[model samples]
Target: MQFQTFSSPHTDRPNSVDKVMLQVILALLPGVLAMTWYFGPGVLINIVIATLSAVAFEALVLKLRKRPVMPTLHDLSAVVTAILFAIAVPPLLPWWLTVIGMAFAIIMVKQLYGGLGYNPFNPAMAAYVLLLISWPIPMTSWLPPAVLSTNPLDFMQIVSAIFTGSPPTGLEWDAITMATPLDGMRTNLDQGQMISEISQSPVWGDFGGLGWEWVGNWFLMGGLWLIYKRTITWHIPLAFFAGLTGLAMITFLFDPESYPFALFHVFSGGAILGAFFIATDPVTACTTRKGQLIYGVAIGMLVYIIRTWGGYPDAVAFAVLLLNMAAPTIDYYTRPQVFGHGDNHG
Candidate 1:
């Protein structure tokens, strides 16, 4: 009797692309809910627009490329990318801009580079950067947290704002929109305001901004769950925190009056989200175990450096994209040794 030959180890892997994507989606729900609570129904509306547009764009591209459509859509990667992009932008961002972002993310960043696994840059982040640079006004027009807003947007008002780029009948845009915590901090510090004075503002919370720190806490919970589920390793997240806090502490120690506390950096902006989700993109991030640590730390350090001195107030997307470019080189230098193979094998 003869048996057919097969390649390598025959054990089944625990995770599939669809499963992994589903888990990520699930992990993000808590953070999404927190955002919705703090920001309003606009958050949910953004997610809806992004998801539909992303699915449409991906299907259209696949059809044009003569590739299998349903199978790829079933993978849920597009949905994940959409959710990420949606959450990163202003909830009241115009609907057309959202569609444009999805178009660029799916067609240019993802499919054009050969779908999913082949893309060099994270599609969501690339699209986010594109929108941010191209449309700074709309991109930065964030709604104040519900507690802080003079006029919190209702569902219909939010829908109208997103679709028509106008506030409700009586409310002005100035009444609803405000700078984010990071942006506020950057602007105040530039104006020679002390951290203690800035922290006294009602917008300020225990660590970060009001509502914003709670959002970070929820994201941290979700991230810890992802780690517990074995969906991601702890190396990148841990190293990311180390690198970010390390730099932040140095600056804060030099002159606490001039710099925000380290925990402020940890809780404000997209630190938690980037550490867990964006930087941990398995395809674009480092593959080697040691490489991941370096990749994460570099991203973290870049985030601190950019937020402190660079033009932008938040730098997660920029940092992640920068490290995506370096991931291959990091993997090359950090490659593990093979068992029974010596350095002089050649």
Candidate 2:
């Protein structure tokens, strides 16, 4: 009798690329809704604009490469990348820049190296960094949450602003735009303001910023859901939070007036989102369990260091990209011993 031979690592897994991407989209919805509530319809508009442009750019690239377009498009990887980039940028970022970002994300960062699973870096983050460095003003111009906005734009006004690069008839960009929580903290800290005094501002919350911490909470819930669903493991997120808060605690204890509380770091600017969503990108992240912990911790530490000292306010994109370059080396050293290959086992 003849029997079929299989590969060394074999299992019957039901998950597919499309299915995984779908779950990620579902996981992001709660956080997206919260952002919309606090920031207005611009969040949704960004998603729509990003989605359309990413699909188009990806299809164009695939056609140029003579690959099957529909199958790749069906996987929804482009859409996921698009959504991430959209949410990371200013809500009222001009439409053309969004298109440019998607083009770079899909074509240069994703497809140029190889598609999807083959790429070593996170496409969304690479594109985000590119846009940020290329156009600092628009990229950093975030708006005050609805509760604090002097004149919040309605749906029509938002659409106009995104397309036209101008707010409503009377309002200037300064009237609607304000620095992000992380930006505000960095700016105030640099100008000789105490953490306690900064926290007294209306935008400040119990931990982070008023609307920002809640957004982080929603993303945290979504991330936990992803873990429960087996869409992601807990190693990265846990290690990330541990590393970030651990460092924050050390500095905060030394000088309470200078450093914000540990939880402030946890609840601020992309920390929660980066921990679960971006850092956990299977393709770009370390695969071995031990490697993942190391990768997560390193990223967390880098984020704190860069945000505290570097020019950028939020350091998620920078930290993740930096570690992406190191993930292969991490995996190499952390690879587990084979069942029958180790000297002791033999």
Candidate 3:
């Protein structure tokens, strides 16, 4: 007969920060690969540069703060931020901009706020907003999808473009780049063009745009997988889509020529990604179940309002950051009362 032996305190747990972040990285794969297939190797290059720089910056910040750098870097939260910021930027973004974004994300938005769980806002989105505001031209210069592009650059050319701002000898900047689907739609609509006329453009697809809609689909699949795995609940994403499509439908029904359909709004921009990834951030998002819905709904409504009328083409980053500021208030009001206390007797 052997006596059972258990560790002190006798507790067992199955999840960790590293594990959750790793799962998120896995969930991001389908979308990342779709971007690569549609855009080119610059996507991967940006990820690499951002990830490496994020680790380096995090380590530097930790060392300056006299903390154990290896342990902090091992958790891989910085890597997640890096990857998110990478995908958010233009594929052909310069190397320095990539470095600056990662550094700002890790050093300013993350580590300086006591690292990881203590940050009040999503680090990646903050960094993206900074870059977008500071370098509007480079940030907005998105390459046309491979299908739309007449001359897609090879890997070496992409590297060269990132480092040197030089396209291949035969091609110039104007020839290789085109507006993203969302940006193009906004531009056309503002120029007195109707949705019907714009839909006939070469960029149009069944839902959003030729290659872009497929990428959004893959991201949706990945988000569903995260929900299935219990990494994230469905409340935020569901509320987000509901709020977005609800408004889009209302507007479209009121004036079909002025507003696009709801599904097109769902599939066109960063709506799905923001709903699933950015808005659901554990550190910055609302924790209470009811509060999460409110948070998500606010983000959704702001997204539609901003993209429709605001100067920016994509408003996901801005919306998430704004709601991040409001999450604490939402949580405070929605916090459940303690059982057997506060007049609710046991």
Q: lDDT value for candidate 3?
A: 0.90
The deviation in Å at residue 157 for candidate 3 is 1.0
lDDT tens readout by residue for model 1, 242-273: 99999999999999988888999999999999
TM-score of each: 0.96, 0.96, 0.95
Top-down TM-score ranking: 1, 2, 3
Model 3, C-alpha of 240: deviation from truth (Å): 1.0
* lDDT on C-alpha atoms for all candidate structures: 0.93, 0.92, 0.90
RMSD of candidates 1 onward, in order: 2.4, 2.5, 3.0
Residues 215-292, model 2: lDDT tens digits: 999999999999999999999999998889889899999999888898988898999999999999999999999999
Q: What is the lDDT of residue 99 in candidate 2?
A: 91
Off by over 4 Å in 1: 1-9, 13-15
Candidate with best lDDT = 1
Using alpha carbons, what is the TM-score of model 1? 0.96
Query: Which window of ten consecutive residues has the lowest lDDT sum in model 1?
Result: 1-10
Candidate 3 TM-score over all chains jointly: 0.95
